[model samples]
Target: MKKVAPPQCLQNAFEENGLTQIDVFEFPEGTHTAVDAAKAIGCNVSDIGKSLVFVTETLNPILIVMNGADQVDMNKAANLLGLPIRKAEATEVRETTGYVIGGVPPFGHAKPVETLIDKKLLEKDTVWLAAGTPKTVFSLSTRDLRDVTGIETGVDVSA
Candidate 1:
């Protein structure tokens, strides 16, 4: 199979972040869902890092990177963030992240939105995440993920 290149947005982000080791894979079958990405990558669903966007009560955008096996506990997340939160509308998501809902990547946003990663994802040595497109994904160690994205250890925002 010919290796398809990652989207320019992802490529620029990876290069700018010095994530030279990251390699993006094309999933023609589609990786729009965690289950599909897990099956394609031959990993547990929990190892797929799902990126979700939310709007705070202040109308600010925030990104949550959680394990595929878990769901965000909005109340807990709100408490942790010290603000009420709700899912971002499609327009808000695209405006904030420069990507659509099913294909939002962890980094390379149009703007630098506040980000929180689920602690559960840190338990794994490696994890997979969307790469600027529904049909592309990339693998990285949990440590490298945090480093590249400038995220701290993580938060217990998953239920």
Candidate 2:
């Protein structure tokens, strides 16, 4: 059987964002959820960077990159963005981010999405994130991730 390749969108992102040093990986054991990804990568669940999508009342998409062990506090997220927001539906998540739920990368979005990182993620030197596919992932230093995303300071978005 041929090995699965990481999505081209993820490749495009590497070139676009100066991430040539990072390598995308495919773990066939199903890294569709935080627990699954952690087990596959042999890392702590808190080291998994889960990219989540939310929709504001005005229909804008927001990407929150947080640790797998944490949950986004809706009230804090709303306050941080200065708007009311709710979880985006699967269709909306796909339509807005050009990726499906459970596969959304922190970067490489189809459109520019307002992004916030959970401060806890910064505590670790490196974290693993989805790479445009549920079974694909890539690791990045917390510092490089901040530089790439242009969000140097993380927020306490976790519950």
Candidate 1: the clashing residue pairs are none
Please report how far candidate 2 places residue 3 from its true position, in Å. 7.5
Give candidate 1 regions above 4 Å deviation.
none
True-structure lDDT of candidate 2:
0.88
Expressed as tens digits, the lDDT of each residue in 1-79 for candidate 2 is: 1235557776787788788777778888878899999999899999999999999999999999989999999999999
> Stretches of candidate 2 above 4 Å error?
1-4
TM-score against truth, every candidate: 0.95, 0.94
lDDT of 1 at 45: 98
lDDT of 1: 0.88
